[model samples]
Target: MATLEGPDVQASDGESDDGEDIPPLGENDNIDAIVESIWVQMAFDIMYVSPNPKDHRKPAYVLLDQEARTSTTPATFQRSDLTGIFRSVLYRELTSSQWETVVFDSFFPLPNSAALKRQGFRAASYYKKWHHLMARLRRRDIVVVRNELRRQFRTLLWVPHPDTDRMWRTRSSMRGFTRLPASSTGPCPLIAINRQALQGTRITLNPPIDDVEQGEMDEEDF
Candidate 1:
C-alpha cells in the first residue's frame, strides 16, 4: 500500500469510517463465482507467460489455447478501482507500439457463449457493448488488464478447460489440450493476476494482497 500523508489520509488501511474493509470491486461471491466458472470455458480467454528469471530474458507470450472462443463480436473493457500508478502502467503497456498476439486459455469459449447474446434488453446490450470494446482493444494488440473471462468475479478460475483435460508430461511442460507446433510469435509483456495457485497446484484465483492495518475500538459500555 502507498503512503497517505496528504488530504487522502482517510482512505488508507482499506477501511471506512464506520469500520469496514473497503471491498474490492466485483468481489461478490454468488455473482462473481458464476462469471469466473463460466469464463473458464470461453473461447478467447488467455493467460500470459511470465519470463524466465534465470536467463534474464524479456518475456515471450504464448498461445495456450487457440480454439477457446467463437465470438466474432470482439471484447470490451472498463477500468475501475485501481490506483493511478497501476492504471498508468496498463496504459503504457497498451501504447508501447509492440507487435503482439493475444493467446487463449481453455476457459475462453464458455464465457463468450454464456455472457454474450442479443437478448434485446438494455442491460444485455450494454454488456455486449462492453465486451466488444475489449475485443477491439485486443485487435490493436494492446496488453489488457481487465478480466476478459470473469470481470465481475473477484476470484479467477485457473483450472482446466471444459472441452479437454490435461496432465503434465514433464515437470515444467504441459500436455493435452493444444500446443504451439511451430509458432514463434516473438516476445511481449506477460499479464497475469498477482495471486498464485493454491498449494502451488490446481488452477485457482488468489486472494487480495493486504499491506495496511485497520481496526476500531468503541467506548459504548466502557
Candidate 2:
C-alpha cells in the first residue's frame, strides 16, 4: 500500500486534546511496536550497506540474542520478525523528518581494512549504501510534498567492532602474541625476552665465549 507522507498523530509526543501528558501506551498498543521496530529497522538499514550484509548475518542474530538475554522485564511488544517488525513500525509511524534523522543518525561509519574484514563493512561503502536507501525512502515518502531535505550528509565511525566473536578472537590472539617484561602487566618476562631475541635475531653467548668456543659448541649449546 502507498502510505501517505502526512504527520501521524499517534507518533507525536504530546499533551492530548485535553492538554494533559499523553497516557502511557499499553503493552498491547501498536504504537509501542512501531517505536521499537523503527530502531531495529534503522539498524538493518545500516547493515545493508556492507560488502556482504548476509555474510555477517551473525551480528544481527547476536544483537537479537543479547536483547533476549538482557530483557528480564516485560517488553511492551514481542520482536518476532526483527527486520519485518522494524519495517512495519517505521513505515507506519515515522514522519519524513523523523526518517531523515533516523537514517542519518543511526549508522556508524565503516572501519579500516583490518577492521572491515572483521566487521564486513567499510565506511565509504556504508555511506554510499545509506545514501541510496535514503534516496529510495525520499521518493516513497513524497519528499517534495513534505518539503524535507537531507543535510549534514556524512557517515560516522563506531568503536568496538560489531562482531563479538571477531572482537574476542582478536583479543585472544593479542594475548597469545604479546609478551610482557618484568615491569609490565603480565607475568612472562623471560618468555618475552626469548620472543624478542627470536623476533629481532638478538643472540647471546653464555660464559662470554669467543668465536672459537662458539664455533666448537655442541648441538646442545643451541
Candidate 3:
C-alpha cells in the first residue's frame, strides 16, 4: 500500500527560504485550468486613468485591487486592457463635440520621448501607451466594450465647475469693484451705484431762437 502526500506538503518539505519548491503534479492539473485562473484574475483587476492634479494636465493610470480595495499606479504596458476599458467609458460619456475637445485640447501633440525625458516625467511609458490607445479610439478600432457598471470610473482631471459665476470668481482676481451680496444665480452683485452722490448739478436748457444771427446784425448797424 502507498501513502499519499498533498502537493503543497511534498513541495514544502526540505525547501530553503531563498527558493520556492515546485508543487508535485496532480491528476486534475491541466493547461486549460491554469489559463482560466489567469483570465478570472484579470477580470477582477480594475484599472483606470485620471488627471493628476499635482502634475498639471498629465494623466495617471491607476490599478484598483478589488480584493484589497487598495490602488497603485501601474505602467501603461502592464495593463493595457484597463486603459482600453476606461477609454471606452470616456467615449460613451462625452458627446461628439466634447470628445473632440478632450482629444484635441487634452492629449493632442503627444510629447516625444526626448521631451518626456527632459521634463522628467516618470510615466513616459504609460503616455506612449495612452497615445496608441487614443489613436485606436480615433480610428474606431474598439472590438470589446467592457461593462462600465462593474467598475468605479473617474476622470483623469478635475472637472471644471459648470456655474459661470463660481468659475469666474475662482479663476479671475476682482481688482477694483467690491463683491456685493451673493445672488441665488449669476455672479456676485457689484456695489450699487449711488445716483444721489453724483457730483454734477442738473442744468435747464433755454429756448433756442430761430434767428440768433439777426440780433448780431442789428448791433453791427447801430
Candidate 4:
C-alpha cells in the first residue's frame, strides 16, 4: 500500500487562472507538452529559455515589449510569426521596383479551366498585360531578388526564440518548420486557434494596366 510522505503533487479539476486548465509545474510533461496546450496568440515577442552548458547559441532578438528599451533577455518567437518579416521585405522590394503584385496576379485568373482560349491565349485582356510584365523579368532579376532577400535576412541581429532553431551550433542553416521535426519549438498559436478555413481564396481586384511600366528597353524579352 502507498502512503503519503513528502509534499505530493495534487491534480486539479481543470481549474486555473481565468478558468484555464493548466497542468501543474513539474519536469513531468516536458516543455513541448506545455507549449502545445497553450491556445493563445503566438505573438510572443519575447521568451525565456533555461540556460544549459551544452547549448551554446543565443536568442537573436530582445523581448517584444522591451523593443523600445535595451534588454538582456532574448525574445522567443513562434515559427509562424516570421511571415510578417517575409511579407514586409518582399513588399518593400516590390514597392521599391514599382512592381504591382496585385496586378501581376491577374496573369492567372481563377475559376480558370480552359487553357489558351480560342485566340491561342491572346483573347484574354489580362494575357497581354501579364506577358508584358513577365517579359520584363530577366533571369538576373530573379537572382537579384533572391540574393537581396538572403542578404537582408543575414543582417538581422535577432535570433530565433529557440536556439535549436539555430541548431547546428557551428553550422549555418535556414529557420525551418521541417528541418527538425523533433526540435523543441515555441507554442504554435496560428494552428492552435479554433477557426474555420475559408471556403475559397480571396479574390484580388484587377488593377488598371496604366500602373505597369514599359520596363527597361531590352532587345530580347526574357
Q: Is candidate 2 or candidate 4 better by lDDT?
A: 2
lDDT (Cα, 0-100) at 177 in candidate 4: 24
Sequence-dependent TM-score of model 2: 0.19
RMSD for each of the candidates = 23.3, 21.2, 26.7, 26.1
The digit string of per-residue lDDT tens for model 2 on 87-190 reads: 11101122334333433222322111123332333333433333322322323332321232222111111111233212111121233233211112211111
List candidate 1 segments past 4 Å from native: 1-38, 41-44, 47-60, 63-152, 157-186, 196-222
lDDT per model vs. reference = 0.24, 0.27, 0.25, 0.24
Q: Give the C-alpha miss distance for residue 41 in model 4, angstroms.
A: 20
Candidate 2: where is the Cα deviation over 4 Å?
Answer: 1-38, 42-118, 121-132, 137-159, 162-169, 173-222
lDDT for 63 (candidate 3): 20
For candidate 3, the 10 contiguous residues with the lowest summed lDDT are 143-152
Error of 2 at 100 (Å): 17
State how far residue 22 of model 1 sits from its true place (Å).
34
Model 3 lDDT vs. the true structure?
Answer: 0.25
Native-to-model Cα distance after best TM-score fit, residue 131 in candidate 4, in Å? 17
Q: Determine which window of 10 residues in candidate 4 has minimal summed lDDT.
A: 189-198
Query: What does the lDDT read for residue 84 in candidate 2?
Result: 19
- TM-scores, each model vs. reference: 0.19, 0.19, 0.19, 0.16
Stretches of candidate 3 off by over 4 Å are: 1-18, 46-222
